[model samples]
Target: MAGTAPSPSGAAAAAESVSDLNYLLRPLHWTAVLRHPSGAGRSPLCFRLYTFAMASFTLSFFCSEVIVLYREGTADLDVFTLTLSVADTDIIWLFRMAHAIVCERAFHKLALQVGRDFAEFVTWDDIPVLRVQCRKVRRFTLTYISFGIGACSCYLVSPVSAEGLPFILALPFDATQPLGFGVTWVYCMITTLHVVVMTMILDSFNVSLIAQLRMQITLLSSKIVSLAKEVSERPENYSETYAQYELRYRLLKCIRHHQTIIKNADLLERSLGAMLLAQSLSIGASACFQMFQIATSENLALAAYDAVTSLQECPLSLKRSLLLLMHRAQRPLRVTAGGFFPLSRESFVSVVNVSYSFFAILRNFKNEEE
Candidate 1:
């Protein structure tokens, strides 16, 4: 189950095992960022077109605001803040769109591999674990969507109450007129909804993958620790050779399982490294670090050592396998930010310190201006 390729017959079963993730992926499909798993919904050309249209609409709005700001030459802090906020969101959305387009094939491959890997856990009587994690992921995703919708509602409605456009964009027509206001308002609503919903889906999808990876690692650690107990429980009639064979087989499976885990982590980093780097820079290092708690390899090594010590009389081959597992696990498994720095707590601190230094310099410059 560990390193073995998924069989054709097991494909559907593997898909079923991780069906819970569709809660995240389904929204992405609707947004045309990805296609439906069954490949029944939209065509590739349609997805590409939809993405391009949305990106163009959002970028046009962003440019309108920038042009207005430049023309007005206003020093109002509120106006400046609003334009800055829009710019930030627009940049993030554009980056997400680019990622969806560039990594489309990689995403599909990763999804299939994830489903296949998760199938291995099904035989371990770990359905409950998967279910528990699925429930958590569902709750988190729904809660996030709810909040996003709520915020978007408030943003779209605020201008209605105040009798203005939702955002400060330079339109050709008189936006104060009823017809112009209606059109502009609807445009803002659509763009805002796109940005908010797509952002949530992409971010939540990444987090869900990390969460599932963490769960797999946890299950693997538990399996390693229980190896000795499982081998000891063999039937009384079982000979030493059979017991040794059983131990060796299970140990090899664990090794393969670890290899699969490492492969998934590397795939994730490769496919989403740029997006992760952009998110870390835009959202802050703390958020990135929180999302990157993918695996605890040291615990895996400890569990292997414990399994070896628990065995009253381990064979030389089995002992060597355990030693190798320990050695491999000792080297931490991590995802990096665009192949640059690792997404660890230490890196988070370094980012924060650098950000603060820059902030201080800007503050000093502003003070001198005053």
Candidate 2:
């Protein structure tokens, strides 16, 4: 059922249809419930941010109606048409918020699960767990900053007349509204903030994920080497030999498990990288295309056309990135808000799970070789 319905008022009926059509075009599409075991608890974690955002968006919707009534009149058709536009904007924002909520759930779940498992993992005391934690911390901090900027940029922009106000601006006021220089100023500021934050987050997360995987590989390799030495040194004594055999067996199993984890980590990294690449290219193309349009020279239209052509190619880039990562993980994920987040940790888990599954399939590639 829809919120808007056709009012009996002859002229108003037309506006209601407009609103309904807008909603129909972009209904919520999250058929995939997050597969996290204990993710219900974490949903509340993102509630504050998203709820505030939704509230703001809803406020904007209401305000736009008020603005319309103020500028125009209570004419049924006019008000109804305005309501339709506001409803359309709200629908888009709602879907976007849903995506953020879903991604946040996954990020929290992967982090918690990984932390729990790592605690139980029996590895050498010399392994750099604390260092790995630090890396993750840096990644998260940077990602939060970057994602904040990127999200705001992609989702909302304030009017030039009200840059000092909240992001929730009244609708274009009228179809003939003209934006002044202030709009560009605000846009520039927001864009600069977005780049700085996204770069910081991506770099931190990438370095941390790689470092954590490398450390895991190092710890497992060391254990395997030590276990091999123990087994080889006492092959003759039955009790000593038996103890050595069990030790070697366990270490070998750990090595195999770790190997799988590493493989999946690699896959996830590529997938995440693909997602970020898509976003960067999209943002860049949007900005550059707009830049090309503002020119008044004879070559301006040509420049704009070239920009549009290049910009059009960006979807192909996004598709390629998604395809590469999807093939690695063997999962068809969308180039969506849920699909590209935390930039690194979440991606690592995705790829790691894939790798772990592969290892399970092989069971004992190393031992079989030996």
Candidate 3:
């Protein structure tokens, strides 16, 4: 399993494991499978349609929202709420488009290798840990999508008769006619579902990849520790030269494992660097706007809720493994925005502080005017 091809049974099991880890991305994978159904099974036509649909609908909505916000110019607290909602929508689509354009091919290649790559780390000892990790991610994704659906459903029904409000808050548009309103409402629902699913899928990809990398680092560390113990306990069996040779041979193996870990991390960054950068900026902007709203408006519940939800969920286990992985590697894998700010817990906290400072300034200006 370490250096040779997996047996037939093993391969089958590995495939199942890969599929389980990829549950979130099943829609995208199925799309690819159906699109071509042969040799790479990546259809240009299908991809174009997916990209076109996401961009056209999301961008059109974003443009409409921006136009309305510009015309209204934050005359009231509702404007901030509308702006916050628009930013959230914009960020989701931004990552979706970036994924389609930048990471599509790389993502497919990585997906294809999942079975083989994962087999290297999964063993009887680590199998339980792997299962627990998978279940955690699965639960998070399910809960995340469930929450989105609930929120969207409430928004859909809150309007008096589904004809009083646009599907999304946007520039004044005609949706007075029953048919027009129905179509707009349906489009918005579809768009929201698509965005939520794609976002979960993308997050799943990163979480799984990082989990695997951490597993490798953990296994490698264990091997190194074991090898050192072996050398210390069994030095009587080996002559000086032979003992040195054995140690060197094992060290080389460990070095190769470490190199593989780095390679995987490099591949991940290459595919997702730009997308992560955009997400970091988008999330930061969303959180900042929500913070501003809470500070300025009497209605605290919605803005506070939005702010809490906008924060990304980082599992404690994954965070620990990541910290360990970075420590073991001696080089942290950073996703940076234009090489200026690295996306990490530190950067996220910095963003919040900066947002709060801006909110303070705005509050002071308002106080002076009052």
**TM-score winner among the candidates?**
1
Model 2 residue 355 distance off true place after TM-score fit, in angstroms: 25
Candidate 1's C-alpha runs over 4 A off are 1-15, 40-43, 160-163, 232-237, 284-370
| lDDT at 75, model 3 | 76
Model 1 scores what on Cα lDDT? 0.74
Q: Would you estimate the TM-scores of all the predictions?
A: 0.70, 0.39, 0.66
Q: Write the per-residue lDDT of candidate 2 for residues 1-370, one digit (tens) a residue.
A: 1111233243233222221211111111111212233335455545355455444644455566556556655454433443444444344333433443445443333333234333334332433453455445555655576576666565445442334322323545332234634563454444334233433443343444455456556556666666667666754645866685677667666766585566647554543554455545544554343333322233444544555456555777765654454344433222233755433336657878999999976877766765
Off by over 4 Å in 3: 1-20, 29-41, 112-114, 117-129, 160-163, 166-173, 235-247, 297-370
Backbone clashes in model 1, listed as residue pairs:
none
In model 2, how large is the Cα lDDT of residue 274?
44
Candidate 2 whole-model C-alpha lDDT, 0 to 1: 0.45
Greater-lDDT candidate between 1 and 3: 1
Between candidates 1 and 2, the lDDT winner: 1
User: Going through the candidates in order, what is the number of backbone clashes in each?
Assistant: 0, 8, 0
Preferred candidate (TM-score higher): 1 or 2: 1
lDDT of each: 0.74, 0.45, 0.61
